[model samples]
Target: HNKRVAIDLTLPEHLPVLYADFKQLRQVLYNCFANSEEVMSDGGKITICAQELAGERLELRLTDTGPGVADDDLKLIFKKFFTTKKKGIGLGLPVCRQIVRAHNGSITLKNNPGGGASIILRLPLRPLITIGHGRRTNRAA
Candidate 1:
């Protein structure tokens, strides 16, 4: 955890609540942040922006000020075991994609026009919630 890696959050005053698996979502975020931190070893900025989309979905975009992914590798960024890091086994982005899909959401990565990379995650605002055996579960609405 580098204290120098600053996170700037630009969010709506009132964001819609999401019915999601907290642990899984947290892990996804951690993976994204870790990747950014690793690439910006000297420290950089991570900007996070969130907004509601047409009352049907929530969009969260995370952008980092590190060198963006190579154009040739963009297609394989979320593939399992495909990594640019010397020590990475390449499961991070794949796992993140799986988690996002399971939540009935979509995740995408793109290089910024000026520099760095941006990851966009879009999820439904209202997920179908069901209770069974004293446990709650969410599904695509």
Candidate 2:
């Protein structure tokens, strides 16, 4: 498919540093960008935006100019082995969710009002803290 697609990736001058595995986080981003490209097979623009949310969280949202996801399928997108694409194994989103969870982050999806879908991922800026045995443990730094 020789479809012409335009990508607009925007990052601010400053961002909150998040603690996450480089490879896993890269994979998640690749999956999202690739999915947007696939959905806009004919040709469309994919806009990726990043911002710093409250509580020092990082928010990244990818919105594509393509057909949006069905309401019924929205909830299942993150489920293991679920997908709407004919050739997709459906493991991409699931793995993304798993990796995000491991980093104490969250991934969500929604349909854009005009058209296409939006994938939102939030990552914590600081390492997670847990208390066990009367001791505070930092998961990652």
Candidate 3:
């Protein structure tokens, strides 16, 4: 199953990272990918991309070539414990939202351009600080 789902990852040249829990982030991403795979069932593709935006913000996008979400469900996808799947506990997306918001970031879900679903995560990147002998520099905007 892992071999069938194509995963693509892209990151910025230089990214400023805020105080984020890496373990939680990994869990969120893993859950997203797992959900996508479940929806695909027969097999499909998944792509993850990240880029640095202006004002020290980072944009992370996850797209899946599976059945897309309906318009009505879009607004409620992030609600705590709300899920459309019959077998799901529905905590995945809500947990993801919580983790992102905890870091002063935001997450949104939408239908992909052609077909399938897309999850977009926007995070405020922290600036870098450099210090030297009697000199200090702030890399955050």
Candidate 4:
């Protein structure tokens, strides 16, 4: 992309996070951003957002101003070895789905209202909790 292409990111405050391989998560997010950039071709805007949800959950969203995906292909977008790209291995989305699922999270893709694609991820804010003495405690929600 070019400098004209805007990428916005937002994250929620006071959110708890589950134990996960951050490296893998970063790779997945990178792949998704790269895909969006490629689809834009000339250049477009990309936005990334995150929020804390009820029940110790987190939500992450990435949206792009590129051509949106076909309605029929939305379901198969995460299937392994399935791709519409001219020179793609077809494993990016699938791998991302697998990684998210492994962390008890979910990944979804949809078309933006204005025209573009959006990928949403839902994750847990705290995978495990330890209870015992000598540990700092916080009020329960």
For residues 1-141, could you state the per-residue lDDT of candidate 1 as single tens digits?
A: 878889999988999898778899899889988988888888899999999998787898999999999998999999999999999999999999999988879999999998999999898877756577765455545
Candidate 2 lDDT over residue span 10-109, tens digit each = 9999876777689999999999888888878789998899999875689999999989899999989999889899998999999999998887789999
Per-residue lDDT tens digits of candidate 4, residues 15-81? Answer: 5655568898898898888889888878889999888777667788999999999988897999999
Per-residue alpha-carbon lDDT of model 3 for 1-141, expressed as tens digits?
A: 567777777766766665457898788788888888888877788888888787567888999999999898898888887899989888899999898876668889889789999988887777334478744343554
Which residue runs does candidate 2 get wrong by more than 4 Å? 1-3, 129-141
Q: CA RMSD for every model?
A: 3.7, 2.8, 6.0, 5.3
Candidate with best TM-score: 1
Off by over 4 Å in 3: 12-18, 127-141
Ranked by lDDT, top first: 1, 2, 4, 3
TM-scores, all candidates, are 0.89, 0.87, 0.81, 0.84
Better of 3 and 4 by TM-score: 4
Record all residue pairs in model 1 with backbone atoms less than 3 Å apart, i.e. clashing: none
- Residue pairs in clash, model 4: none
How far off is model 2, as Cα RMSD? Answer: 2.8
Better of 2 and 4 by TM-score: 2
Query: Per TM-score, what order, best first?
Result: 1, 2, 4, 3
In candidate 3, where is summed lDDT lowest over 10 consecutive residues?
132-141
* Candidate 3 TM-score, true structure as reference: 0.81
Q: What's the lDDT for all of these models? A: 0.89, 0.87, 0.80, 0.83
